[model samples]
Target chain A: MRVLIVDDDPELAELVSRSLAREGHAVATAADLESARAALVEAFDVVILDLGLPDGSGLELCRELRAAGASVPILLLTAQSAVGERVAGLNAGADDYVVKPFALAELRARVRALGRRRESAPSVTYRTGDLEIDLSARRARRLGLEVELTPREWVVLECLAGSRGRVVSRDRLLEEGWGESSEAASASLEVLVGRIRRKLGRDAIRTVRGQGYAID
Target chain B: MPSTEPGRPSSGGRSLVRRVGLVAALTAAGASLATLSVAMVVVDYRVTSDAEDDALERARALAAELDAEARAQQAVTQAQLEDELREFSHGDVTLAVWEASGRLAGDPALPSPAQDGCEASAGPDGAWMVCRASSASAGRWVLVGEPRSQLLAHREPLLLGGLVALIVVVLGGIFAGISVGRWSLRPLVRLQGALTAMDAAAPQPAPSLPRSGMVEIDDVAATIDDLLGRLRVELERSRHFAADAAHELRTPLTKLRTELELRAEEHDEGSHEGRQLLRSVARVEDLGELVDHLLVLASPESALRGASLVSVSALVEAVVEDLDADASRVRLELEDDGAVVGDATVLSAAISNGLGNALKYSKGPVRVGVQDTAEHVVLRIDDEGPGLGEEARARAFEPFYRAPEQRGTGGHGIGLALIAHVVAAHRGDAAFVDDGPGAHLVVRLPRHRGVRPEQT
Candidate 1:
């Protein structure tokens, strides 16, 4: 996953970026809202924004990103974390607020939580016995650790999970997930199912003979 | 007594009733004396006039009797005429008869009487009133005379009685005047007492004094009642301002505290450097200190006390937990949960605002603790926030006044003012202590030392 860190404190930014990088996530850092804006032009899974930026308030950038329909989760990191600032940060479309001098472990936990929430479905949490797929939160948890899924995998799973134990045709999965006609295809439905199996395990999805697929 | 007039006490100090009373007493005495004097004179004149009339009647009767006797015999001897005159004579009266020749009967020293009508004269004896009438049978004149002293003999006692009555009227008037003056001052005295007592304990329902029978006094009482009502309203407004100040400042304080806590880490250790990390661990503490003070300054005083036994430590812990700042930053290091008699809800309301404010503006890793003294329970919230300056502390409770540097910060400026009201209402005190690294807000409430250990 790629993430952008917006902050005026270059040292703090580097430290936070290095910590996140150790988790196998690619990170981009911006010193101010201007560079942050330019950095946001590229695709990123999440953003770490600082409220007290040298160029301008991080609130403006957070708001701008939300207004422009960027669906990536925002985690605000600031030194002056007052109650009102937290509320304002949330109001500006920040998914989470973490005060300065915070534990690195806590910040990482919150960022992951935000990312998971962004990947999940908002309205429904699909449950197949012990395995639950929260579409709004966009995280699929089986046993304990979540089964991470890409955006396309999420769309495909959403179609299958909506079947509620019924079989869904491969054609439907392609149409819903990729928005492509039945005749057009980039990745085959069988190959997508194989990737989901590797992450979720074989029992998470079931093949109905020659007709279609379903999740138990 | 509001106006000062020369030759008169100011209306505020003057007793009009006393003046009215004195004038009434004097006038009554004077009028009574005048009426008694006129009555005495009339009594004297009527008595003397009546006496003179009686003498004239007596003279006529005597003249008629002599004429009848003279005519009956065709002649009256001088000796018989003298006897007849003597018969008509009595005490204070003398009779005389006149013939064409000379005097015929009665006192020879008595002067000739006027035959036309009655006349008064000074005789050798005393003042005399005389009347003469013609003899019916012989055409002779007969006169009867009386002294003036006989007519005025009964009037001396009457004058004496009049003098006594005048004295009584004057004394009675004075008494009445004094009584009226005191009765009129009753309302003012009571009003003064009521006003004096208000400073110690303001009567909630307000004392509604009965109206004085006097209209002016009643009017004054009404105005005082109106004044009391206005004072109560002003007090209530101050209480509301306290609550509002807490509400207005609490939100921002919460944000600040949260933001600060997020930046703190384990030992502030970092692998990268461009900007120095807050390594002192106290940078956050300083911010917390300032916010903690501000929180206490934003609540209403009345809301800070209750009538139950409250454990100060537990209460502080709960309130701090409720704050919006990161919980990891706040460390509860309380040795004593000192007990106090107060309403927990009321106390918590005050605590909540302060906590909210601290959460907004202070750095995390804050320490909230409790200390108990002999007379009071102290709740202390210590944080690493910028401490309040000496100048800000002095006028901290003034409404709508911010520090010069904070003028443009979006503050409604009633936070500390409201807290002052809360402290006063609950009979508690709040102190913003500047102790080195952090600002400390210490709230002291009167302790309860009774059997309330098991209470909330």
Candidate 2:
């Protein structure tokens, strides 16, 4: 996976690049919006964006990318955690949002998830246990019965289902499914999982207590 | 009342020591002048009276001598009379005589008598007579006398000189008072100048006040210096707090903004990834708000006390209006004319924070209401959600407090803390109203006047 990181802070950009690199993704860094825009022309699997820039906002760039109908995954980075801000960013067409001072592993996981989502593979369907996801149709079914999930729940399920049998840390789930530093992530995730469990049955997923969750 | 204008240094502006010295000098001068005037008048009166008495006695003796001469029928020549009269005519006296027939006698230079006998005394330019008569040679008589004016005239020069000396002493005393006044007030003037200089040179050491040896001025200067020291300490503390808050906020903001820009750069417009990036940017924004609220809560100025006129109804309306978009599921109900006297900003912030919290936690719609109670303006915000337990409710307003159920709700726990601070600033109280189907938080602020509608 090819990931590009754009940030004004060289140290933070480098740190993010290194973290993503450690996750087996080729990472490139840009310290400002212009260079990052130029790097966007080059084929990249995902982009990790910092909202604040010396010359412009990351949000404007995120909107530009979405307006151009480019399907490359974008993960926005911000210092704020206000709901209105999150809503605005989401409304502006960002796939995910993350607050700064985030854990390295969390950033890596989010980048990996974005990469996986952005790849235009031939198969648009995903299967995990008895659950099946049709990406092209925007539908999920278990036991051939359609399961209704909120947009957020779908993202969470998608990230978890992509990992399939692997343990997905709570932090990674928060960063990938919602945004990093989401105060409501765990509770929201619990609610989502409770709903998912009602449809798919409880034993289909394994809770790892303090560590994470696994789906078999 | 004394004028505030500065007086001349030689006058009332003199130092205390000099003024005291001048007062002593004036007192002595006055005393000397009084003594001199009294002494001169008394001595003049005494000498005049004594000379008159002596002249009267000498006239009796001379009359006796003239009587004995007349009895012997001795012819008295002009020259002989003059020679005899000269013996009585010492300085301060002049003698003359008249016969019983009213004829002038004694040197034949005397003016004719208008009337015989003795007359009341006069002085200076006026003449007065003291007369004595003796029988000579069968009912013929000779009169001997002196003018009283002659005796008083001699002392005129001495009395005039004494009066002049007294006038001079009094004038001198007044001059001395002015000089003394100026000298006495010098130390006070010096202290005032030093204080002015100190104020002008703010943040710098003040020049020492002149030690005029006046205890009162010295004490005043010391007190002013101490007050300045306290002010400086307070200023330094305020500066320290501002610096600490700035440092705390900047690091996180810088990092978050940098990362947001970085992430925004790689995604293309209208892409699924771009939408995620925008959402991330929005979350970053929330952090800025959190920092702002935290700094405001931490500020000492924000903790200031004292109540002002605040309209609870209007404040609630304003806050609800701000939260309307976000609180689409909430309804606000305000009682007419819910007004209170309190810190308006603090109250508003508290109410808004409560509303925000209610909206954030509730699964269903939230409700807010303001009512004018008898003693307080009460505000209540209720949300249809899982209310806190006893333990969570107890520590809800504590700094950085988060319930186990709410830890993953994206709350920093500072919202309730901010509400608490706002309530405290208003000198009001806040508490959980209920724990039933929905969470209800109530705040009460005291009633006050001057709640203008236009101001709100």
Candidate 3:
């Protein structure tokens, strides 16, 4: 896997680059928006962009890259935890966002997930036991009968299914489902996963204890 | 921002309209009464004086005629004099003839004449004005008397007219006072309308107050506008300060966290250095969480920009399930699934904070309940812990305020404050009820009916 990290702070950028490289990925670093654009000429698996840069905002760079027909997955690194800021970032064509001071393990997991998602077209549906999940249509069925799930329930279910049996961390599920991964949201995630399990069968989703949940 | 200040004069007294009317009426009545009394006295004096002069003139004329008759007859008898006196007597006036020897000769019913040209004397019929005339040729004196009551008879109509005038003046004064009162207060009423139109909570500036062309009212409106503008600037400054501080600290914190993780990975699991590194990482995470809370408090609107409908029962059940081992200690009873409209993340966070406090503060089992009413959806959490004192309860919602007893519990003291802020933003109330045997934290939010299923 190849990765590009764009940030104005050299210390943070160097640390992240070294960590990703140590994980056996070809990692590149850019100190500002201009260097990031120059480095983007080469192909990369994932682009980790910071929201604030010395020369310009990373949002503009994201818009320009997307407008120029680059579909490579881009994950945003933002210090602001505001809903509006995240919404804007996603709306400007970023795939996901991680708030500042994030754990290195969590960042590695997100990067690996983003890189794997680009390797192939996502499966349109998932089936286990009597439960069948249709990702494209956003519907679920049990014993060939349509099952009802609230909007929040569907989001949590879809995130787990998209991971292709990989353990989707609790915090990642929270960010995907509730747009935030705060301590308070962890409780909601736990309850949401329980409801999904009851609807699809107790064995449909497995909990990875102290880590997250997975669907096989 | 409210206009009701202590220095402002109270309108609790008698209304301006009534006060003006009363003053006008009293003044009108006083002036009219004084004028009427003076006019009546002067008119009475003139009438009485005229009556006395008439009586005196008649007496002299009668005496002159008697003298002429005596001269004509050469020897007038007493009987003839009596005949002349009787002929001269008329209605409301009588004539009396007195001899030079001080003897009354005609009209014995009349009072004895006094020695005076004209004088008021008490007579059998009320009081009379009497005048004396002496004729030397006839050796007789003629006295004419008239009642004083007849002289003042015209004053009765004058008194009736004065009474009518006084009533008219008083009524007119009241009407004029009322008109002036309404006209003068028009500007103040307009000022009140302008004040009521302003919405203090809105992000937009208040509309400019319309001018009433009155100096005092316009001055007040201008001052209010100035105050609101200054307040807005100060608020904007503080919000920016919080946001900027958070942004500046994030990069360094991220570097520190990444360094700690890398160093921890190099050592064995049970090594002291590895354990200390992990603990330092946890502390950094706590600091990051604090920054997030500060940003939320500084700009709650930005946090709630993606609001949607959320079920209270579902959220509560989720928070309880996350408790894991603590779940066994919680007794959950959900009576309603009513929804409230707000950001799901924020609402859940607030609920999580509430439940976390109960579990942290109490050793015994906690009871959590949800109920819906006509207007509100309530979430009550009761913990078997020491209840807050009166002073603690009052200051519980203040940011970073920790009760003295709860200081060593290892919390940032912002959990309850965050709950208060989020609940208030959703138009809800959060408080510690005084239910006995424990501390009861109640959150009541306005129920949102007919929420869309997809949104919920």
Candidate 4:
């Protein structure tokens, strides 16, 4: 896999590149939007774009790439962990985002998830047994009855349902739900997963012991 | 007596209306009484003088008649003349006869004058106006006198009229003064109403006060508006500075954290060096969290960007479970799972901080309750700790303020402040209620009616 890292800080770029390189993937680094634009000519599996650049913003690059018909998955790296900033990044056609100072493992997992998005049209709904999840509408119904879920609960369930029939890592789910996969938040993820299982059913979400949970 | 306090009005001083009326009344009484007294004195003098002139004319006519009688009868005796004079006396007048030999022919008690003209004399018969007249033959003189009491008789009615005039003028002045006072104070009253209508606690800037067309009141209002504008600018500047500083710190902290974490991973798990590296990485993470808290404090309104309906009971339960503190000791009394509209992430963080504090401070079990009222959804966390004292309760929500007793607990005192910021941004209230033997933290948010529409 080929990865392009667009960041103004060389140290962060080096650390991320070194970590990804150890995972046996080819990584390219660009310090500014100009270099990033030049590097976009080549085919890449994933693009890790930083929000702030010396010359211009990475959002413009994300929009430019999408406007030019590039379907390659782009992930945003932002220091501003505010939900508004993340929404803005996603709205500009980025696939996912990680706040600054993110764990390398979480970043790699998000990269893997983005790379897996090849030639498959994203589904708006997922169904397993009597549990029906409408991702676009952010609603869930069991046996034709709507199951009430809070906003945070919905975020966790949406993440699980997005990767249907596959194991969703705990850190990734935490990052998506709580915006931080810290030790405290990881415990929150456990409690939240237990709630989702209870709302759906006992056999709704299968916990794969120390690994994570999956929806079949 | 009205109070001198600026805004509050107390009935401790005389009203301006009454003062004005009293002054007007005094002025009118003084002027009216002075003019009436002067007019009454002049009228009394005129009455007395006119009566004296009439008495003098009567005396002269009587003296001329006596002379005619004396001339008509040259052989008439003095006794016969006295008899004729005695017949002329009537009412309050006294008839006296004086001969040219300086002797009284009749009534010797009558006062004798040296020459003709009128004179006032006081004798055993009280005061009298007397006039002496000579006969045409100059052989005899006649004197006629009247009491002064009869001459000044009209003065009583004049005094009564002066008193009545004084009373009427004073009453009229009072009425005019009150009406004038009320008319002139209309603008001031309007200015007070406008000031009372201002909402000082609202997040939005207060609207400029309406013009009262009074210079002093309008000047005060303009000064208040200017002060508010300046305060708003100052507050905005500080918030922006805080946000910008936190943002600038993030990138360097990110590099340090990643480097420390990567370096810690390179060593064996149980090695002392590896443990030290992990601890350093944890410290860096703590710094990052501090930065995040500062950002939230700086701009809490921005946290509502992705607002949605959040269940208060569920949020409490989730936070309680998430706490690494002994979760088994927490007793959750979730009476209602009501919903509120806000950013779930920030709300969750605030709840987690609250529950975390309760568990950390209390020795016994912590009680967490979620109940919905008519308009608000309330969350209460009760801890059986040494409850916050009066001083602690006041300053607990200030940033970085730690109670002396809780200082050695090895945690930053930003939890409650962060909770306050989040609650205020959501237009909610967070308060500490003293419910005996524990610290009770109550957070109340406006209840969002119905569940959020299926999120789009």
Candidate 4 lDDT, B373-437, residue by residue in tens: 88898999999999898889888999889988888897788989999989987889898987898
Model 1, runs deviating above 4 Å: A1-216, B1-46, B68-87, B95-113, B119-128, B136-140, B165-207, B212-217, B231-456
Worst 10 residues of 3 chain A by lDDT: A142-151
Candidate with the greatest lDDT versus the true structure: 3
Question: Each model's fnat?
Answer: 0.00, 0.03, 0.48, 0.32
Comparison by TM-score, 2 against 3, better one:
3
Candidates 1 and 4: which is better by lDDT?
Answer: 4
TM-score of chain A of 1: 0.57
Best-first order by DockQ: 3, 4, 2, 1
Count the clashes in each prediction. Answer: 82, 71, 0, 4
TM-scores for the candidates: 0.32, 0.33, 0.69, 0.66
Candidate 4, residue B219: the lDDT equals 85
Chain B TM-score (model 1 vs. true structure): 0.41
Q: Per-residue CA lDDT of candidate 1, range B23-119, in tens?
A: 8799889899889988988997787777767777888898778778777866778787788777788876888888678788777656666564587
- Tens-digit per-residue lDDT, B90-174, candidate 2: 6645566556565444533333343434445443445555544454442433444445555567778877887787678767766
Give lDDT tens digits, candidate 1, residues A1-216.
788999776666777787788777899999988899899889998899988788889999988987998888888875432334564786687766765555566677667756655655345676764467776445566544434344456667777777767998877776665546454353446656755654455577888986788976
In order, what lDDT does every prediction score? 0.65, 0.65, 0.77, 0.76
Q: What range of 10 consecutive residues in model 3 chain B has the weakest lDDT sum?
A: B1-10
Candidate 1 structure, TM-score to reference:
0.32
Best by DockQ: 3
Two-way TM-score contest, 3 vs 4, winner: 3
